[model samples]
Target: MNIGFIGLGIMGSGMANNLLKSGFNMYVFNRTREKAKELEDNGAKFCSTPKELAEKSDLIFMMLTDVRACRAVSEDKDGFLESLSKGKVVVNFSTVHPNYSLELREMVKEKEAMFLESPVLGSKIPAQKGELVILSAGDKEAFEICTDAFEKISKKAMYLGDVPKASYVKVVNNEAFATSLTAYLEGLAFAKKIGLDPEMVFNILNSGALSNPYFEFKVKKVLNDDFETHFSFENMKKDLGYALSVADEFKCYCPTLAAVNEIFKKGLNKHAKEDMSAVYKIFDE
Candidate 1:
């Protein structure tokens, strides 16, 4: 497959590396052109514009930050829409609004192209290991054709039926993740202030039914005070906002997520560029 990828941030960079290692010829672009330099050095062709990349590839993957970026990439003068061709597939791995995905789907279809919503369920480490979980939706044929690529990028790629369904699933999944992580971190924060060893708190709960591997991995980072950026607080806040939008559209009660969103906002206020784990600082802040 002649493949292209735009956006080379934390998650995107590793995903691009996996695609390159999969032996596909890659066309690449990023607003911060320097971000693509590493991949360009690795034999990926670098393009100046999304349209240029779109024109030259049969498949393009977008791992952008928000709905605005996603829309701009598609509709801007030198964007994806300008060069979209029939039968070409564009797979978006960005966590954005489902309604925006639906609108983009229609725009892509108008050009006889297919748009696949493929929001991922892991951050930098998982992307580096090609172990992210992919929730995909859109044209079944496009999904099938991209299965091999998805295999190279994720541990599992599940096809959910249509454009917005995958987006909806992604937001729901992320909202739950934020809520769960917030509650866990709150416990750790409480343990610290109350003179209990936070590590013991993590160790005890982590040994029980509610345990998850990520809980252990993240606790190590927290204990070490290593708040490097795998997934930034900025991006987490963006996804949290998108998830809340989904909740509102469905008229679903989401007090937990609503409160969680504010917590992430506060985290971003001070440590905007740091990893989401920096939200732990919320206790001290």
Candidate 2:
């Protein structure tokens, strides 16, 4: 299949490379052309515009930043929708508000094309390793058609049956993660304040019933003070904001999520571009 990928950001670049390595014909585009260089060098066609990319590919995947960027690329003069034809699928890997996913579904439907909200769970490392878990919704037939491509880039691909479901699940997952990470960091800071070694505290936690791979991975970054951007604080903050919006739509009460969102918002003052682990610095402050 001829696959078109837009937004060659941290996660997108890795996922697109896996598809190319899987032997699919790949076309890529990015606002910053330089981001597409590596993929181009790997034999993927680099299209200058979304419209151009869409015209040359059978299925399109977008891993854009937010809802606004997603809309701009799909609706602008040289956008993908301009060249998107019937029977084609457009999968979005970006984390966006579930409501917007519904809108995107309708937008693509209007063009007689199928759409899937397929936000993923994993960061730069897992994406590069082709181990990200894809939670997808919308158009079962389209999901089946893209199974091979999904398998190439992800360890698992789940079809949750319709727009907004997968988006809701992804938003909720990120919300829980933000809250958990904040709690973990706060405990670590408290441990340090009480004259305990932070690394020793992490070691204790890692040996207990609460031990898990995610925390194990993040704790190492925390101990090393590595805030490099596997996933940016700004993006996590954005996802928290999306979670709040989703909760409001469903009339759900989420006081903890609200507080966690504020914590990420505060982190934005200095660590917006750094890894989400940089939130630990807030506790130190």
The numbered model that scores best in lDDT is 2
- How displaced is residue 148 in candidate 1, in Å? 1.3
After TM-score superposition, the amount by which residue 14's alpha carbon in candidate 2 deviates from its true location, in angstroms, is: 0.3
Q: Write the per-residue lDDT of candidate 2 for residues 1-285, one digit (tens) a residue.
A: 899999999999999999999999999999999998988998999898999999999999999999999988899989999998899999999999888899989989998999999999999999999999999999999999999999999999999997889998998899988898889988998899899999999999889976979988888988998878999999999999999988898899999999988888877989999999888889888
Task: Estimate the overall C-alpha local distance difference test score of candidate 2.
Answer: 0.92
lDDT of 1 by residue, 1-285 (tens): 899998998889999999999899999999999999899999999999999999999998999999888878889889988999999999999988888888889998999998899999999999999999999999999999899999998999999997789988888887887788778888899998999998888888889986998877877898889989888888888989998878888899999999999998877768889888788889744
* CA lDDT, candidate 2, residue 63: 97
Per-model TM against the reference:
0.97, 0.98
Give me candidate 2's TM-score against the actual structure: 0.98
